[model samples]
Target: MQSMSTLVFDADDTLWENNILFIRVVDDFLAWLAHPTLDHAAIRAVLNDVERANAKTHGYGSRVFLRNLADCFERLNERPATEAERREIERLAAALVFDQVELMPEVAATLADLGARHELALLTKGDDAEQRRKLAASGLAAHFGSVHVVREKDLAAYLALTSELRLDPATTWMIGNSPKSDIIPARQAGWNAVFIPHPHTWELEHAALDPADTGVLQLPSFTALRGHF
Candidate 1:
């Protein structure tokens, strides 16, 4: 087997706690919509519909999620929001930004150790602005030699990165939390994939894969990665 020298990682839930904040905010919004004057199920349905419709337009992140909340409120009330309602939404959205995000224990140490031996890069999918901010805040930014933030993680993106970096797929590994966005595509592109499952990954990010995808390895924690390479 070829020894891996280049390592790529997905941001967001892979390195830090992210989706949990979104889920918490959504749960709070649902609670607020459960008042006597509102139909909880109807409100949830409208929010789901708005999310499905706007997901492509706004993409994933706190901003898009806040927009969905605003749309859901308007649909529920059937009128423009009062100042108080608007303030509440803004407050909740702002709170989501500072919800105590932190790197998983051992992630920083593992990355630092791995970087000493490999060409480490971060390849993530999100709004570039938010992704960059998160990386900078996490203090993991400096460890990576390269970073790529794109709309999606597909075969083309993987191929392009390998081409641009002049990396051999056989010796490159992609580590991430999402099977749909990271593992499947990387495996398809003939790159080694390591799955580090996050506790709060979104349902849409899940994907089924063949058992023969032996190049795709799953681990309970990032600490286990030292042995894989």
Candidate 2:
């Protein structure tokens, strides 16, 4: 690690507890459904399929996700969802999103320590306004010199960001929990990456990195960065 380098961070599970909130809502939804024939795993498969398919068209956010759950309910129940059911789903989705922005252990202090010497930036992908709202509520927004909330974190997006920021790929490092979105793509974009694994990361964000990419450094947790940077 070099002194005063640009450090790009993923906003969700890396910096704070994010996926767990959605998981809690999904648990509640499954319990409420109470399908007599389907086991929890079976039910989840259907819902996961629905979410995967809908993601392309609807994008991600509480509003889009709640609507996808409603569609999943209809797909499983064989009957149209009632107004009450829709409202209940919305109520559950509302509980997360902007309400809970709990930072991961030692994240605030670690970021504070790193921010003093490094150029901190935030790069997260989701619904733009919703992601910003969460960042605003988190109270860590001020630490970042710039923030980017994109629809997706693909190779092109990473390259575009590097160009836009006028960053040197050799000195810029991306730190995050998602290998698929945050690690692999950032590495492919020619930036060094620090991967801090999260146990309960969202299933869709999991990927095995190619052994050939030697630019990535793996750390056990967020606070460990203080030792390296």
Candidate 3:
């Protein structure tokens, strides 16, 4: 029924407004700190170090990220933060986790159309609970055949998913906004990758495509995705 054998989609940013919401919440949290001299960039750099270290073991999600932030705040300030300050920071982080899922433009229509004719799967990297919660809230769960949420998006994880799906890598397509997490790994696993670039993608997720390889495709918008099928 479909031109492609299967389609694997990344949950955040590709299907909905995820990272940008996190960015906004981080900005709010930073403002609440009221540090006049430390700009957002410097503050984020400190936070990034903490997150990267924590992510290796705790994985990605709001809970782990919030904890890392708390740790970073204390380390940067050279003293433990007050309970009230921690609470304020947590409140901001809570908004990101509990907020209603906001679909990108044409996501609903596009998914509905694609679902009718193809096998669709959702793959994301985050804490199991938070990722599942977001997927449930997304209202797009019905469209997917299965979902996989991992602590990391590496070659092993991708291989495991494809093995479970009984998919031929050459015929499967991985679609997402992050080059590091979605595109490169999929391509490395011998799967076709379609990149739907998002402006607010996280710095850690950034990666440049190789010049010689041309199999990877890029779509300007979600609405344009149907044309490929």
> Which one is best on lDDT?
2
Could you tell me every candidate's TM-score relative to the true structure? 0.88, 0.95, 0.94
What is the model-wide C-alpha lDDT for candidate 3? 0.86
Poorly placed runs, candidate 3 (over 4 Å): none
* Tens digits of per-residue lDDT for model 1, 1-229: 2354899999888888888878778778888767566566666667778887877787877788888898888887788788898889888778666334588888899998887778899999878888888888888889999999987788999999989999899888999999888998898888988988887887668788777777988898988887765
What is the Å distance of residue 8 in model 1 from its true position?
0.5
Ranking of all candidate structures by their lDDT, best first: 2, 3, 1
- Whole-model alpha-carbon lDDT for candidate 1: 0.83
CA displacement after TM-score superposition, residue 145 of candidate 1 (Å): 0.8
Query: What is the alpha-carbon lDDT for the whole of candidate 2?
Result: 0.90
Clashes of each: 0, 0, 0
Which structure is stronger by lDDT: 2 or 3?
A: 2
Deviation (Å) of 206 in candidate 1: 1.6
lDDT of each: 0.83, 0.90, 0.86
User: What is the per-residue lDDT of model 3 for residues 9-86, given as tens digits with 9 covering 90 to 100?
Assistant: 999999888888778887887787767688888888888888888888788888887898798789778898899978
